[model samples]
Target: MKILLATDAYSVIVNGVITSIKNLRRELISMGHDVKILTLSSNRHSYIDYDSNVVYLGSYDISKIYPDARFSLSYTNPLIDSILTWKPDIIHTQSEFTTFSIARKIANKLDIPIIHTYHTLYEEYTHYFSPSERIGKYLAKKFTKRIYHKSTCMVVPTLKTYKVLKKYGIDENIYIVPTGLSMDKFSIKYPKEELELLKEELNLPLKSKILISVGRIGKEKNIEELINYLTKMKFKNIHLLIVGDGPYKNTLANLIKDYNLNNKITFTGLIPNDELNIYYQMADLFVSASTSETQGLTYIESLANGTPILCRDDECLEQTVINNYNGFRYNSFDEFSEKLKLILNNNGLYKNFVENAVISVNENFSSTTFANKILEIYEKYIK
Candidate 1:
């Protein structure tokens, strides 16, 4: 089977959507299926990289909202002819913007089914462009409903997302497919010397208990809550390592300075994807206060590396984190502080959580399993 994945976010933009799409493509190809990517050209000039199975459409940078994303101006891109010639059996879209509109056009032209995965909840991202929250949510809902109605089927990463769409009155057939990760990648052993070198390089305290969070440092992420909680903690050797960069970096840096907690928090602007697993492995625990995640891939990645998670309680994490079994979830700052102290101070409990973390990821979130589940969805519309 031939599959085409169309997304506005890809290549240079390193986000969960791109990660999920790449993993799905790799697994599908390994299973003897052909996959091609249709995305905006990262280069200033548009070109097609046939060897890489990618078609880059001409686009203008959209750095105001997303630093590395671009918006294609041409509704009828010149490369559409070449994509039509490839004759994909199905089109799976990962975004709701330019690439998605193109997906609909191509699907209508080729008379092929288009499957859409709602990755980001735009309502949570209103701060980027909308003048007011009310207007932003109303516009986001209208846009989501319009694009989703065109797809043959809708794929949501979690039941939480499904509920959101249903509440918006979208009566489409929605399938819950959690994004999968290459668990083996995280399990690979990094040399003890390399780990030590990384710690020294990042200036991470050797004796400190590392509490790391990986994702965009955005307002919607609610990272300020994590920083605030860190200040109130009674633990002395605890250090917060925020991994990733975003528009909210300056705001967070200012907040950190105002509280005079610079020593307690370290912001490692943006780490390369290849080296990210090492950070997760080096950490004693992974933590996230963000409530906007669809599936929280970083949580799964941390678990795969045998690091226990302590995250804000959200419905999306219900299937991933088993409280007390693998990790604990908290509803408020007080609850988070209590859980953090209990998990960090108790050596026996920490050991059990670490052991259960690995087991949970292997059994439920393997990339192979994710691809197989997606294949089931593809078959439903492929005819």
Candidate 2:
């Protein structure tokens, strides 16, 4: 099988979409298939990596809309012509923006089915456009409905996202395919000596229980909600380590200062993809209050690392958080506090949750399973 993955997000962007694509590409290639990527250039200069099977279209910076956002004119290029010559068996789109437009053009020219994956719920990002969530969602629904109507089918990471698209009145086939993790990469263990060195470098208290949250620092992420709850809890021996960097970093730092909880929270900005497991391994638990995630890849990543998660209650986590089985979800600050205490204080329960966390991810979210499910979708449209 020859698959062309079209997206604006790629290697440079460290988010769930790119992570999912990387894992998908790896598994597909491992399964004896050819895969190529079409994405925007970091700057306004077209480039192609024939060795890696990727094309980076010339684009202009659109960071005013979102970080590292690049936009292309969707015009014909020699690189695009090469892709057309290759005659991909399937065009799987991971973004709905300029890249989707570009991919749709190829799909039209080559007469191949284009499959789109709903990675982010843009309806939750009203803060970026305006203060009106209702208006934002309304506009988002109309735009999404317009964009996705052209694709043969839509693939979503969770039923929550599937329901959202249905609410948008998109009648196209929507497949609920949970994003898969390359579980082995996350399961790596860092020796205690190296873990101690990491703690020392970050100035994290060596003896304190670590609660980590990994994602972009953005308003939509609802990170402040986590900080607010942490402020109220004031657990003496628990420290929050926020991993990753984004536009909202300064605001979060100031919030921590205003609450005088500087000692309780730490930020290690933009850790490389390969280094993620070390932090997860060092943490006793994973925590997040973000309701914006479609699949919450970090939840599975943490669980795969044998670290249980405590997250805000959302339909997206229906399968990720199994309450007392792997981790617990909270509907309110009181619930969050109570659950945090429960996980940290009970050694037996903590051990069981850790064990179950690995079991759940292995059973449901491995890269092989994700790739096979996706391959099934591709085969349905390829002919």
Which structure among the candidates has the greatest TM-score? 2
Model 1 lDDT tens row, 1-383: 99999988666333678789988998999999989998887655677888878888888888886655688876656678888888999999998888998989899989999999999888988877698999999988998898788889899999999999998998568998989998767758677788778878889888899999897778988999998888877568998999998888999999999999888889988876767889988899999888899998888888988899999999999989989999999999889988998998999999999999999998999899899999999998886
> So what's the TM-score on candidate 2?
0.97
Q: In terms of lDDT, which candidate is strongest?
A: 2
**lDDT by candidate, in order shown:** 0.87, 0.89
Clash number for each model: 0, 0
lDDT for each residue of candidate 2 in 136-175, tens digit (9 for 90 to 100) = 8888888788778888999999989888888878756888
lDDT of 1 at 248: 88
* C-alpha-based local distance difference test score of model 2: 0.89
